[model samples]
Target: MTSQPPGAHLPDHPEFLWRNPEPKKAYDVVIIGGGGHGLATAHYLAKNHGITNVAVLEKGWLAGGNMARNTTIIRSNYLWDESAGIYEHSLKLWEGLEEDLGYPILFSQRGVLNLAHTLQDVRDSVRRVEANKLNGIDAQWVGPDEVKKLCPVVNTSSDIRYPVLGATYQPRAGIAKHDYVAWGFARRADEAGIDIIQNCAVTGFIRKDNKVVGVRTTRGDIAAGQVALCAAGHTSTLTDMLGFRTPLQSHPLQALVSELLEPVHPTVVMSNHVHVYVSQAHKGELVMGAGIDSYNGYGQRGAFHIIERQMAAAVELFPAFARAHLLRTWAGIVDVCPDASPIVGRTPYDNVYLDCGWGTGGFKATPGLGWCFADTIANDEPHPYIAPFSLDRFVTGALVDEHGAAAVAH
Candidate 1:
């Protein structure tokens, strides 16, 4: 299959050879979860390390999980250095991802502005912007007037509750087409001779001397030299197959899109205090969402009050969006960690690794996550870029606190 190289686009009718490869009897690696991260992990294994004897097991179709449901926002601004490092690495990959994967990911680097609504919010954002710059990440602070100039539709008046005080702007941050990312990674992995088995769910683990050697799936028991569980919201269930436990709590994260209108909202605007985010897609539909459900639940749907308040905040911020017809609303399960960071390292079992606990921020970290995960799985050690987010951090009292920076934008 031939694909137009990046920046060399034709009619976009690239041939595809990726298909349902039956589960193999044994493989060097088996990545569970066929979403963006899983497929990416598989692709990197073959493309980078020449580990082509790999299989990706998915319960559903590729990108059918949170991979497709997310708002597709990408950025690297974080308060902590560790969080900033990996995310910045991810953002760097996102920069050339479409070309590297031979797919047009529709990456628009317009910018991402995190809106501040109160004095404390402004201070917090100011500190974050400074820290981001110090870490060699591009970031800036924009006052209310500059925020309006960036996104003229934003309401900057202090008359309303949680008024727009200012914002932290990342000029390099923006959105990418999520579906292209999924399909692109899948095709690339397939081209590298990696098998992608869909509609197959992992039921249990094959262990020896407390080491996970393989997994028992709906298809059959497939043995592997190593297993990487990239399951997003269902990390706990997958880990349960080994009789182990993690601190992952599943919560509902809801998002909605308005009917297509003329381009009005320019860059992505995320308001943490107001608990809403708005970004105009390439198709002109405004994608909006807010914080996760307050309680833990596995259902892919959340309480209406969460979306209701989100819409209310949207209208308060952009009154013009009030008249915009709501076309569709959906929710995805987000695996929340206690410190609102991600888990991306080895598990208790020697041969098993995990890339879960991303909460709402998994989509943006796809490339970097897979790159590091593939390295970790291949060498049986953690990559320096992803080492800080290891499972031991939870017990080591060295958590990367990104709750305030991530809760609104993911």
Candidate 2:
């Protein structure tokens, strides 16, 4: 047997990554949501900004929300510069994240293939590949034969419903163990003295004039010098208290996995036309995800038809999957913006920072968003990478609009 690469091994019984601290009476910074984004932000706040007086309040267990529910695909082959900037930055950080956090995240560079099924898809995909290359991201367009060579399980037959004309391949794009990624950040942040308070839901905001001074949580009212909203789907619930509405809609993004199987799939494959994304986990489960549900809801469970439809597409793409037994299905509530991009800047309240509307890109953008958001909260200025994602962009009509590049439908 060969030795595993650094940060690629997981112990059978992992140690606790963080403590179950009680909510403090007040903190210099109060971050809502203890998922990947919230935990990463706290990690950066302590590591980068020297802001250890921070509290990450979560309604549920850490990383148990969308962090555990996501498909864990990481890539930066986007159409727009803003999208590419943040995502590529995140991908670069992911390359060194395990060493930085001093924990195992099991990050793999197995690459990703975004298939193009139609003539228009081919044109758009090739254009995005050029855009990615121009932005210094590793990307290229591969024909059907190349796709087959990369992932032999893929059915590149022209007679299929959505024939694979070609695909944009990102050689560095892959996946990490979502739970371990969050735990690594959480452990580092906790070691730096940042409080990870779980089961403390932020019920409302405490404001002094135009500034948010604290939050009312189930634990109690806690004072804060600054409030950062890193809550994913439940962001609007807190934002509504600020009296301004974000042009966002919440939907349940569904994913499923198959029983343990032999390693047949070696890379991530996503098809916008077929509305499915497939990747094999390091532990042998065939992880798969489909487009978000059409209805506006926050349930962790989605309609069975959505699962049935995605499996149909999966079988067509990988015929061997037709006999795979489904392990389980789950959903994550994602807040989608009208322009298909995120909003990550100042809100109506002076001391409150907004980081929502990530839709399907949350897990991939965790570290990059956390790094930039910590800077935004520390220096009280928008990070250049996230400047284009400010809430004002919606009103100013300067939307990033990544519908075509967001991969999974929103």
lDDT string, candidate 1, 1-410, tens digits = 23444554445664343767788899889899999899889988987899999999999877789998999999989888988888899999999898898878899998999988778888888899899989999999998899999999999998987788889999999999888788889888998889999899999988999587888999999998988998899999998878888889999899999999998988999988888988999889999989898898888888999888999999999998888999998998899889888999888888899988888889989998889899998898899989988888888999887878653864
Alpha-carbon shift of residue 292 in model 1 (angstroms): 0.7
lDDT for model 2: 0.89
lDDT of 2 by residue, 39-100 (tens): 99999998898999999998987778899899999988888999999999999999999899
The CA-based lDDT of model 1 is what? 0.88
Cα-based lDDT at residue 124, candidate 1: 88
TM-score of each: 0.96, 0.96
Question: Clashing residue pairs, candidate 1?
Answer: none
Stretches off by above 4 angstroms in model 1 are 1-17
